[model samples]
Target: MRRSRLSTRGLTEGAIQAALVAVLALLTRYVPLAVLATTFLMPLPLMVLTIRHGVRPAVLAAVVSGVVAGMLSGDLLTGVGILVAVAPFGIMVGWGTRRGWSGPAIVGMAVLVSGASLVVNGLLLLAFLGINPVQQYGEMVLTMRQQMDTAASLYGRLGLGQEAAESYRRTMLAVLDLMPRLVLFGFVATAVTTGWLNYEIARPILRRVGHPLPALPPASTWRVPGFALWLLPLAWLISALGWQPVTTLSDRLRSSLPPAPLPVPSDLGLNLLALLSVALLVQGVIVGWVFLGRYRLHRALRVLLLLWLTFNPIFSNLLLIVGLVDSIFPLRERLGRRAAPAEVKP
Candidate 1:
């Protein structure tokens, strides 16, 4: 009799959570806060359900949410979008937390889910909806070019010489041209960032709800594995060696100094370079945090330092380099050891 009552209560709770998830999913389709809700808030209800009720209940809630969203939006595509864009992320994060995974490991899982969802959704759209994302991206680039051309006078009014303005336009166009080719990498990066942000937001809420949550290591103590540094050199070598023949051909064609052929780095090389840079940047930020705590830096100084590193490309690169060297050398560990006796002495 007691077991039956417990089972009944569990089902009731799951239904309530499912309804909440459905409501939030429906809200994501409306105006005003649509983009913000879809991007950041839509996953929270599912995440809350998963944390409170376990995987089975959470999965059921997600399916219910999708169906309700589809019915409300008057299209099955809404359900498909929820399944593709939101369900996997919430499920993975919740499962990872329940399984006691570290913050980085959970984040890695989220990235994989996000990237796979992007590919799957793209294929679905092309196969069923007759929409080619690549063609749409190309159209977007053309539109941007047209807008930039119309704004040439504004550039001139900003004191840019014709040559400088033209160079700026060319640079912007080049980035747009590259966007379609780098879509996969961009998706993965976005997923990784979003996963981290969501995890940070969810951690405190989960704790408050009586879920077992692991504490992340302090930023000063954080250390990425050292082998990531090897990718930097490998990426540079591949970039230099992969396109020699193309470079030679382009040089021959450009004897009259017309626009040179744009050199395209191998996708693998670009991915490796980008991933390594991000890892090192994270390590650098942790090292900075350690310094601030060890030396008791003022709050305002710390904020100013962060803003400077964020806005200044040169300083950012320097931080990345510092992070790379620290990965191999364990600079923070050494410094902490040296400071220990002084700290202990009164």
Candidate 2:
């Protein structure tokens, strides 16, 4: 693929856009918009520059935005965090533009930005606060227990069975045991919300800040593809109906079978394997959507998140099924397009 060559004029425009993005990033911290800006806001300028002048300008802008945002966040480490978060957008957008896969390119950029930002921010917090990982882990377990109890109480109030209560507890424990997996899942959520808002909220604000890109598409153009949107719920539904019975069967077998000594919950080896499986499964679905569905990048991301939330232990089987059912429209559209056309009359 030929690269989108940047002219001197393009470079000038990119610098202006980058500055605008940085200012917007700074403002988001002060006036809380309906949008969570950190993940989405910081990337818009980069995206704009990429769209306008290909990747070089986008990268230059990202570097500038990172510096500005770091300064505003008030720590040298935070500035580094900002760079880590935004630079991926530049790289992905550049690659995407070069290859002419605009949607995936943007989506890829968003994913990288969100994932990196989350990691950078998490680490920065730990570094600055002198947070104890061991204590935090214990506290996290307690928090999980509280959330599970709440789910259980909700189930009981809704007249669900002992099985429901048990599942809630088990699932919550599974969630905590899968912390690394959860962090990965969180990126999906961050990307969806961030992408939507970046296009809707941040772009206009950045434009007003005297930084505009060349012939930029409307941010909403970055909307999740309709098919991908539907795939999410479908994935959840399949997981719920498919997995719930299996879970129940496993539980029953574990309870009723001649009890071989049960495995210890604290077995790190087993826990690590479980985490790896969940991560791979979640990632597999994302990859599947990317290839199978004629959808945009945003939709692929949203679907991935839904699958993770559904199968990754955050919600019940019923909830997962509900999400799947909700995604039917896009699924229908996607499938319909792939169907062979009817034969012409002789």
Candidate 3:
């Protein structure tokens, strides 16, 4: 009898949370503050339910939310979008936290799940709708280029020459060409970042509500595995050695085949480099945080340092290098040992 009552209460709570998620998902489509709502707010209720009730309730809430959202929007695709975009991420995060996974581990799992979900959704769309999304996006990019070309006269009046306008258009076209190839990596990065942000936001709320949450290690103590240091160099070597040969091979194949295959080596190398850079960037941020804490830096100064590191490309790259070196050298541990003697003297 007691188990039955507990189960009933769980269902009621799940339903309420599901309704909240549906409302937020609807708001994201039409709201003026769509970025803020979608990034931070919309995922909260579902995350809370997951934290409180575990995986089954969370999955149920996600399905119910999708259904409710579909009804409100009058488009079944909207429901699928919600399920694909939001649900798996929340579920992975909740499950990881419940199992006492570390911050990095949780984020890593969420990124993998998010990437897989994107691929699956893309496949589904291709199978049912006869639509190639990458091709569609590329076409949209071309359409934009045409529109910009039409506006070239306006640019000329604004003192920009035709040559400069044409150069800008080419740059944009190059970026668009790369976008489809990098979609999976980009999705993974987005998932990791947004999942981390949501976790930081939800942690305190979960604590307030008496839910158990895993403790994240301090930034000063964080360390990437040593094997990660080899990735960037390896990627560079592959690109340098294989790019020309692969391009020639791909061209020959393209001439022979009706449909051209993707340039695998180039795409893989670029994506691997990007992924390694992000990992190093994170390590760099953590190293900065550790230094700030060790020196007892003023709050304003710390904020300025962070802003500079984030905005200045040179500084960002320098930090990435520092992070890469530290991974192999244990720089923080050495620094700690040097600092240790001063405390003994005091």
Candidate 4:
């Protein structure tokens, strides 16, 4: 009898959540302005359901919601695509909330999910488009190079000279050389951001609705794992290897079995460097936020500083150094000891 009631309750909650997810999906799909909103709202129902019930029920609910959404939208592709993109992050976050996990742990899981989904996206692109992104990028570059050559010939005839055209092309290629890694890191960083945003949004709403998650630790105390300091050297080492030696080493290490149908990123070093940079960058941002409160900087100054940190050309390397230093030594704790009594810690 007790088992029956448990099953019934799970079903009831799952049905309600599944309906909500479907409604959000349809609403976000049809309402053009609500397009950006799918990211926040679509996963929310599943997340809340997972928190209240468990992962199993949440998975079931996701499938049902996807089906209902597909039917309502008259297209299964949109439903499935959005579900794959957003559901894992939500479900993992929900599980973390249920288990009393920290903010970073939850976000880490979201990163993994988001990264794996990139592989799925690549596969889909290959299946439908007959070429993956890396291949498409190479083709695009080649086409652009040909166009530049033709343009340079015209420039030379016009007395403008080919030097300017060649230089422009070189500059563009150099900036786009590390695109694969940039794309991957972009997804990773976005997953982290969305994971954090969901938790921040969910915490107060859940508490008021009587499904409060464990409270987040103070942001001033936000510290990456001690071992994360190694990422700097590891990234640098991989980047130093570049593509040839790295690919050779990988080939030697890999088994003699046939390669998978999917494409592998040739610029392995750049990918690792980019991925590691994202981790370091997050730590640096937190360090900045913590210090902002530690010194009681003026609100206007804080805003300007944040803008500079985000937009400055030197921000990447600067933040990378700060993150690595903070990871190796307790810079926050050390500096925090001297903070004034009136200053509020983040």
The best candidate in terms of lDDT: 3
lDDT tens readout by residue for model 1, 1-346: 9977766665677677667666766776676567674556666666766665567777777788789888988978778888787888887887887677887788778778877887888888998799987788778877887888757758988888888888877877776766655655676687777767766766786777776456666667777787767778888666554533234456557565543233555665666677777778878877776666677788788878877895576888978887888999977766554243544555
Residue-pair clashes, model 4: 0
Please name the candidate that would achieve the greatest TM-score relative to the true structure: 1
Worst 10 residues of 2 by lDDT: 259-268
Q: Write the per-residue lDDT of candidate 2 for residues 1-346, one digit (tens) a residue.
A: 1343447767788778767766766666556772364555566556556655667667777777668767777756545654665556545544554466645445545555666666666686688888754457668777776788778878888899878788777866776765643443444566655543444454366457664322345322222333554444444443333312124457658567542233322233333333334433443343344334444447757666656655654353444333343344343234324557789999
The candidate, 1 or 2, that scores higher on lDDT is 1
Candidate 3 Cα outliers beyond 4 Å, as residue runs: 99-103, 124-133, 136-184, 243-264, 335-346
3 against 4, candidate with superior TM-score: 3
Error of 3 at 135 (Å): 3.9
Q: Rate the local accuracy (lDDT) of all candidates.
A: 0.72, 0.55, 0.74, 0.71
The better-scoring model by lDDT among 3 and 4 is 3
* After superposition, candidate 4 runs with Cα above 4 Å error: 128-173, 181-183, 224-226, 245-266, 339-346
> Model 2, which residues run further than 4 Å from truth?
1-8, 35-38, 54-56, 71-78, 99-123, 131-138, 147-346
Tell me the lDDT of candidate 1.
Answer: 0.72
For candidate 2, the lDDT comes to 0.55
Worst 10 residues of 3 by lDDT: 257-266
The order of the candidates by lDDT, greatest first, is 3, 1, 4, 2
**Model 3 lDDT per residue over 1-346, tens place:** 9988877877889999889888888887768678584646666666677776788888898999999999998878768877887888777777787777887787677667766776777877898688887777768777776776667667777889888877766776677667766765676686667556667776787778776456567766777788876777877765554433234457668567543233345566677788888788778777776667677789789878877896676899988887887798877666444254544554
